[model samples]
Target: MQPQSLQLSGIRKGFGADDVLKEIDLSVRPGEFLSLVGMSGCGKSTLLRIMAGLETPDSGTVSIGSRDVTNVDPSDRDLAMVFQSYALYPHMSVRQNIATPLRMRNLSLGARLPLIGRMTAKASVLSKIDAAVNEAADVLQIGHLLDRKPAQLSGGQRQRVALARALVRSPAAFLMDEPLSNLDAKLRAHMREELSGLHRRLGATFIYVTHDQIEAMTMSDRIALMSSGRIEQLGTPDELYQQPATVTVARFIGTPSINLLPVEIDASGRVMALGRPLGVSVPARYAGPAMLGIRAEDLRPAAGGFAVKVLRSETYGADRYVTGHLADDQAVCIVMRQAAGDPIAVNGEGLSHLVFPEQRAHLFGADGNRIETTVPARIAI
Candidate 1:
């Protein structure tokens, strides 16, 4: 099937007096897997529903490959949506569920009944449906479960069945709204690999909506990080992680969260953290209150850096994370990579010196926007 590009322009939506989507504009490339990710009530699902023609936007247009589909019906939009719920018929077998779309589209009402329809239906139509069903089953590796009902299959198998049903249609694009949210952790991880592999094999456009940043980071070609009613940032996983445009984007995209410390710029334009000079300089224009953001990995153990008293420590196999508080009442965390030879111990009373390289730090202004700064050639560590 030929892939189609999906585009949304000037999209806005509201409920009663509350505005949900505000001037949303996004363009999805052909055969690309784009994820719309944000917390609940961020309007990611609503934007997806508009793309699927499931909901009408208050304003703006939706186009698929140059054809406007804003006002089109869901079925006529040439899009297939897989909801969070499996939405499979409990009484239908896997084969029947996979064949439902083809059957509905190709068969007449009188030709769809139990025994009478079989006699009235064209042999060519039945044969085509069977071929499509088998092909979809084979693609999903669920051919052996054709005779099983939804009640008999595992959650992952049921999800695959639902995907197969969507696959049989060969729609222009696929819109999935948290389809794997119900699966257990291990199964969800497995399904992430499966879905990514399926996208590569099919080369079909995929718009995945989820609240999980991990899901978006792992599988998407580009992530559209939605917040409130707008896209805060849209870029590849690395770009969003390493260079976030706002404090919200930085806070939302990483695991264990980025550590933010209140900072300020001295009269000499030097950045200061915990009331101590950080040996980094910002522009004279930014000589005021700021926020210093650093990832746990960047906070390394240095010989004579700022002192922090360990408050707690947690181990996860090969790594240990020590959480502590600075003398100035600022919280800090250091991720110690476990290694042989040198053994490090973290306890409630232990004191450690932590330092983050000047280049590794992120400076945000009082309004939560990133502040571009210049580092001095010489620095005291």
Candidate 2:
């Protein structure tokens, strides 16, 4: 089947007094892998369920390709969903599980009966189902496990069987809700690559929902960062990371999390942090308190930057992270790459000059909205 784009417009959902999803509007391009990511209570899964027709939205519409499936049943929506749990039948072999969908969709009620149905079923339909099941098994490389039951398969193997079952349907889109969450760390990492490769090989539109930022970052063409029943930001990983629209978004998209420092604009329009000038200028019309978001990698050791007393240090292979506090008791961290031989010793009295490059700083206003700032040619660090 040809790939189709999925779109959700003005989607809203709620349970009792609390609104779980509020006015969510998103579109997935054909063959694009889009990940809906957020914390546990952030409504990512609710939105995915709405897309799958498992839950009806209080408002808005869901469409697959050009057809509106808002009121359609899950089966009639022509999309396949792979759940977090494998949801496999322990009593049935992998082959039978993979062939179940085709059997249900292609066979008549009388023809589907146990012994009588097998004899009454058309030879051509059975042959087609076998061919499709074999093709899906080959694609997932689970042909050898066809005769095995769920109890006999490893977690990864079972996940592949679930994927094969979904693949055999050749649906317009695939909706996967944390399909790899049940696997161990190493296996989950392996499956991320496998799934990414599978998406490319099949060229199918995949709507993956996960709370893991790393999975979304490494696998999705674009990510929709949701929070408080709404989509906070939607863009490519780099776009969301480097140019976050809000402080909340800046805090959610990175590992170790982005460091936020309370800052203010002076009478002359200069931004200051920890009582030292940041050498960046906001518009003269703008004033008052704001936040300076600096990624760990952006904080570098410089000669004349603000001095911070080192509180602790940790090394991970070739990289070292130094955590410290400024004179005013503000926290800061510096990430050093390829420093196998160079270690930043942590002493109560040790001081490090840390620079926050003006161009690399992300400025957010008191309301949490991002504010554009300019970096002067020369900084007063």
Model 2 over residues 30-51: C-alpha lDDT tens digits?
A: 9999999989999999999999
Structural similarity to truth (TM-score) of each candidate:
0.92, 0.94
Candidate 1 lDDT by residue in tens digits, 49-124: 9999888999999999999999998988888788898888899999999999889889999998988998999999
Off by over 4 Å in 2: 330-338, 342-348, 378-381
The segments of candidate 1 whose C-alpha lies over 4 angstroms from its true place after superposition are 266-269, 330-349, 378-381
lDDT of each: 0.88, 0.88
lDDT at 96 for candidate 1? 96
- Candidate 1, lDDT over the whole model: 0.88
Model 2 — which ten-residue stretch has the worst lDDT? Answer: 331-340
